[model samples]
Target: MADPTLSRRHLFQASAGLAAALLPARAQAKARLGDDGLYTEDWYVDSFLDLPEDFAAARGKGRGFALQWSQRGCIYCKELHTAYFADPAIETPIREAFDIVHLDLFGAREVTFLDGARLTEKALGQRERIRATPTFQFFAEVDGKPKEVARMPGLLPRPEFSALFRYVAEGAYAREPFDAWLGKQGKG
Candidate 1:
C-alpha cells in the first residue's frame, strides 16, 4: 500500500543525517588535544622527574615523575608535543601515572634544584647538554644528588614510548638496561 521508492529515499536521507551528526564528534575524538595547546605559553607542560630539595635529601623515596623542558619555535619540539604528548593515546596515561612539571626552556623563569640551587630552564638545559630540542629525561635522586637515569631524544612511536614508560614506571632500571627490558616487552 505504501510508496516503496519514497520510503527508501527518506530512509537514506535519515541515515545520511545521522552520519553527518556524528562526523564532528568522531573528528574531535581523533584529535582530542589537551587544553595546553601543545606546549605554548598558555599552559605549562608537566615534568614529573624533578624532585624537591627535601625529597632529594632523602635519596631513596622511590621514583617520582619525570621532567620535560621545552621552548617555543622549535619544530621538533612542536612535533613531540602534537604527535606524542597531545595524542590522547599517550597523554591520559602520562597524566595518571606521573608528576609533571613544565619548564619554559627559553624563558627567564627560575627553578630550584634538588640541591637547593636555582637556575633558569635554559641554563639547566645547557648544563644537561640538551642541544636537541624535546629531550625526555628520566630522573632520580641518589645520595642527595639529582641523577639522570635515562635520556631519550626526539619523537618515539606510541608503542615504543608506552613500553619505555612502563619499564621506567616499574623501576626496571634498578636491575637492567631500558633497551634490554624493551626487547623483552616487544617479544611478549
Candidate 2:
C-alpha cells in the first residue's frame, strides 16, 4: 500500500532506537563484581533462600550436595535460574536435595566450606575446567568424600535437566554411570 521502502526504513530506525534504550539497562544489570569477586547478594530470588551456614555441620563429615558454578554476566545462567531453578516445577526438588551455592567463575572472594578451608571462586572454577557458563556438576558422597559424578554444561531443556537433578538427588548415580541410569529411565 504505502511506500514499502519507507515503511521498512522506519521499522529499522525504531528497532535501533529501542536497542539503544535497552543498552544501559543491560549494563546496569551486569554491574561489576565486588572486591570479594562475588555478587553483593548471591542469594537466590525471594525470601525462601537458605543460608550456607545451614550446611556448615555437614562439611567433610559426609558426602554433601554442592552445585558447581555460576557467573552473573551469563545470560544462559540467568535463564537457567529463572526458567528452571526458580520455577516451582523444579525448585522444590532442588531445595530439598542440594545446598546450592552461587559462585562467580571470575570472582575473587573467599569461599569457606563446611570443612573450614577457604578458596576463591575462580580457583574452584578452574579445578572444574569450567569453560562454559551455566554448568551443573553433580557430586557423590563416596566413603565420605565428594566425588564428581556427572556434569551438564549449558542450559538444558527442562525435562532432561529435571530428570538428571532427580537422579542425583535420589542417589541413583550411586548405582551406575549417569548415562546408563538415564538410559534406564528412557532419557539417555
Candidate 3:
C-alpha cells in the first residue's frame, strides 16, 4: 500500500539524501590539494614525520603503514588523486586499511627512520631509492621488527592498486607474490 501522493522519484530522492547524511562527513567530500602542492584526503594519517612511531601507531590501530612519496609538480601524482582516489571504490578500502604518511621526495623535512637515524626526507628518499614521484613503501612487522614488506614504485591501474593494498593488509605477501595472489583472485 504505497502512498499515491508519494511518487517513486520523491521516495528515491529521500533515500539518497538519507544515505549521504549517514556517511562520514569527510567521506562525501572530495580530496583536496594541500599548500604543499600535493593532493591529500581527509583520511590520510597526520603524522609528525617520525617513521617508526607512525608505524607503531598504525599497528596499534590494526592497520598497515606506508610512506606515500610525491613531489610538487608531478602529473601522475595528480592523477592518482584526481582519478583513482576520486573513486570511492578505490579509495575507501585504502583509507580503511592503511595509515598513509605523505612525504616529499625532494623536500628537506626531517624524518626519523626506523633505524634511529634522523635525516631529511630527500636524503631518506635517496637512501630508499625512491627516485620518482608517487611511490608507496609499505611496512609491517618483520622478524619482530618493523621493516618494509612491499613497495609500489608508481601509480597503478585502479584494480591492481586496490589489490596491492589488500596484498599488504591481509598479509598475503608472505604467502606469494602480488601477481600470483592477483591471478588466484581472477583479477590478474
Per-residue lDDT of candidate 2, residues 1-188 (tens digit): 76656677798999999999996653334323445433322333221113235344334343345554667667776676545654556756665556555667876766654344566778767866888877876666567655666787877788888888888777887788767777888544
Order of candidates by lDDT, top first? 3, 2, 1
Model 2 CA lDDT for position 153? 82
* Best-performing candidate as measured by TM-score: 3
Candidate 1: C-alpha lDDT: 0.61
lDDT of 3 by residue, 1-188 (tens): 87669888999999999988878654446668999888877778888888889889999999999989999989989888888887778888888889999999888989999878999999999999997778999999989899888999898888888989999999998999988888899644
Each candidate: what lDDT?
0.61, 0.62, 0.88
TM-score of each: 0.65, 0.62, 0.85
Number of the predicted model whose lDDT against the real structure is largest: 3
Q: Sort the predicted structures by TM-score, highest score first.
A: 3, 1, 2
Which 10-residue window in model 1 sums to the lowest lDDT? Answer: 40-49
Give every collision pair in model 3.
Answer: none
What is the total number of backbone clashes in candidate 2?
2
Write the number of the candidate with greater lDDT, choosing between 2 and 3: 3
